[model samples]
Each structure stands twice: as structure tokens, then as C-alpha cells.
Target: MLAAEKSKKTRHVLGISGGKDSAALAIYLKQQGRVPEMEYFFADTGVELPEVYSFVEKLESWLGQPIVRLGSGKDFYHHLEMHEGMLPQATRRWCTQEMKLKPLEKFIGDDEAITYIGIRADEFRDGYLSLKSNVKPCYPFITDGLVRRDIFDILRSTVGIPEYYEWRSRSGCFFCFFQRRDEWVGLSERHPELFQKAMEIEEGVNRRFSNLKKPYTWVRGMSLKELIADAEAIKEKSALRKAREKDPRSWQEILISDRQDDENQACLVCSL
Candidate 1:
């Protein structure tokens, strides 16, 4: 009988979520002169924020190589139809699986690969771990004992933080259900067209799936129209939360803390 053939080479892959941590990880790896053969990729959801695309371009220039864009070739609407027009939620995050994870798995195929994740040492979350037996996860930040501050430092010295950080906290689709009410308001203010698109999706879903146990709006208990109607109050409450900060060391620290507060509830694959 012929002996079983084994994989000959291992692929080093890093996924840039267009967020600070993943961006920093790519820069960190480059600076450390490790993983020179690393393959960088971004799983584009096609509906990601404009800032995310711009930030990814900036990071690409810094990395001096193209970050391959992986997509299921089917946009969000196609997946919505596949899921029977039920909008994705925190618990039912079919979007992440269909749009993000499955595409990633398809890209890697059955190849033996080392996928690098950007979860910081301070974070207790286990980022997206593929169940594929041939694909293994490696957390460089955790192994190097790097924390949030270290990530910021890396970005500061490199491509700098993503511009979206000024408004939204995490990187994902413009209509991500994980976004806070204030972030939704930020979307309306910053990119009204995308915000309108999101609202339209919500309205359509609600109209189609009227019998769903819960309303099909992105925000819980309120439609996008209602959320925008109360945008001022949301902004005021966000401002008050900021004012309540006793003694932040710096504005960066405040931003970091704000992100950490929300990341716990965010999708590991999409947000991190």
C-alpha cells in the first residue's frame, strides 16, 4: 500500500479586520522581521464602512504588499435572501459565518496554515478559531505579552488608528447589529447614504418578516427611524458618559477604554 501523503508547506496568514489590533499585528510582525512569507487578507463584506476601505488601503501601503480581499462573491442582500430575509443579530450572526468565516475557510481550503489572530494579552476573549483540523490559530500579541497600549503604540508609529475610531468603535459592516445606538447615530451623521441604506434594509426586513417573534430592526426595541428621531438624546447620553470619566490619562486612553467596553459583546471574527 502507498503511504499517506502529508502536506509539504505551511501557509502564514493574517486577516486584517481594518481595526487597530489587526493592523497593529501586521505592522508588529513586519517590524519584528518575522513571518516574511506571511499572507495578508481582508474578508470584505462589500458593505463595510468607507473608512474601513481607506484604512485598509493605508495599511496595504505600509505593508508594501497587497492585502488580498476575500469575499463570498455574494453581497449582503443575497445572504439576507438566503436566510429568508431575517436580519442578523448578536445571537443569530449568520452574516459573520456566511460572509466572513466561510469565505476564509474556502480561501485556505484544505491547506495546512497558521492563522494569526490579534486578540491582545489583556483580553480574555478567544477570537475566531476555525474547526478545520489543518488550520491552527496563533496569537502573537498574547505570546509577546502585548496589551492595548502596545497595540496603540504600534499603530501610532505606523499607519495610525483607523479614522472610523473617531465615531464608531469597531470595524465591521456599516449596518452591523453589534453597533451601539450612539454609533448608529454616528453613522447617520458621518455617512448618511450608508445610514439610509441600513434604515431601508431594516424597514424592508420588518415589512417582510412581520411575523418574527421580534422586530427586524437593527437596534433592539426601536426602528432606525425611531433611533434617528432620538439621536440627540443618544448623543447627549454619550457625552454625559464621557463627562463621567473621572480622570482619564489621555484621550487615547479614553478611546481605548471605550472600545474595550464594547468589544466584549462584539463578534470576534468581525470586530477583532
Candidate 2:
């Protein structure tokens, strides 16, 4: 029997999550002249912060090549409906599965490919572990022993950090449930329209799934309505906590520091 037609050539891909480490990784690889044939992509959730799209465009300019956008072609609302009004949570990450990872896998197909991840050396957290044998992940930062400081330096030396980093620590949809209360407050202040959209999503889900044992909302333990009602109080508590920290860092630095303190690793596909 004729041997199965040879498969397509191996592919090199790097996903830019519009976060520091991932953005830095793309720059780092290009600077180091590694993976010269790398194909960059970003899975657009269609609900991401405006800054994210801008940052991706900046990175594309630096790379001198387009970072392909992959998705189900169905926006967040469509998938939310497909999921039966169940809001995506950290634990029940149907959003990530449907919107991010699946789109990635579909883009790569059955071709043998290397997916570069941006988990830094200092981080003990892991990224998406694909079950597809043909799709393997490589952590260049970890292999090169680069840490958080290295990532920052890489970005500062390039297009600089994404604007959203000024107030938010991670990158994902504007309505990501993983957001800390302070970050949510930042969203309300920086992008009131997007925050309002998120609130509307939560309110809609709550309405559609009223009879469910536990309704789905963006924030746990409270609705977006309650969260925004106490937004000023949340900001005050956050400021006091920052004052107590006694360390001088920009808002971005403080936000990153707080992230480490919480050790709340989010979806690698979305954050890293």
C-alpha cells in the first residue's frame, strides 16, 4: 500500500494573548532570531478590551507580519447562548474551551506544529496542555531562564507594554470572571462602556437562568450591580492595601505583584 501521503510541513506558531509575557515572547523570539518562520496568531474573543486590539496591532507592526486572528466566527453572545446562558467561570471555562483553544486547534488542524507558550521561568503555573499529539507546546522563556523582570525589559525595549497594563494585570475578555475586584473597579473607571456591557451580560444571564440552583454572574458572591454600587469603597480599600505594602511600584507593577500574591493562575490561552 502506498504510504499515506506525507503530511504538510511542521508549523511554528506563537499566540499573542496581548499580555506582557506573551507579547514579550514574540519580541524575544524575533530578537533572538529563533523561530524565524514562526506564525503569530491571536484568538479574538470579540469582547476584549479595545487596548488589546491596539496592542496586537502594535506588535504586528513590530513583527512586520500580520498576527492571524482565529476564532469560531461566532461572537461571545452566540457562544453564551450555545452554552445555555451559563456564564463562564474560572472552574467552568467553557468560554476558553469554545472560544480560544478550539479555535487554535482548528487553525493548526492535524499538521505537526510547535505552539510557543510564554510562561516565564519564575512562574510555576502551567499553560494549555493540548491533548493532540501533533500539537506540542514550547516554553521559550522557561528554557532561556527568563523571569518577570526579563519580560518587562523585553517589552520596554520594544513597543512598550500594552496600555491596558496600566490598570489591569491580565489579558482576556473585558468581562473575564477572573478579574479581581480592584481590576473590575479599574474597568469601570477606564472603560465604562465595556464594563456596562459586561454588567448587561451578567444581568441577562441571571434573567435567563433564573430557575437554576445557582445563577451565573461575572463576579462571585455578588452581582455586577452590587459590585459597581460599592466601586468607590473597593477602590478605597485597594488604595489602603497598597499603602500598607510600602513598596514603590507603578500601578502596573503593583497589579502584577498582587497577582503573584494571589497565585491565581488563569487560563493560559487567555493570559499567557
Put down candidate 2 lDDT per residue, 1-272, tens digits, no spaces.
33344456788999988887888999999987998899999999888888989999999999999999998899888998898888888889999999999999899889899989888888788787779999898999999999887787888788987778666767889988888998999999999998998888888888887887776778888888899999899999988987898778786565544436232368878877
Instruction: Encode model 1's per-residue lDDT on 123-166: one tens digit a residue.
Output: 88887788989999999999999988888888888888787887
| Steric clash pairs (candidate 1) | none
CA lDDT of each candidate?
Answer: 0.88, 0.85
- Quote the lDDT for 152 in model 1: 88
Runs of candidate 2 exceeding 4 Å displacement:
1-7, 252-264
Clashes of each: 0, 0
The clash tally of candidate 2 reads: 0
Top-lDDT structure, candidate number: 1
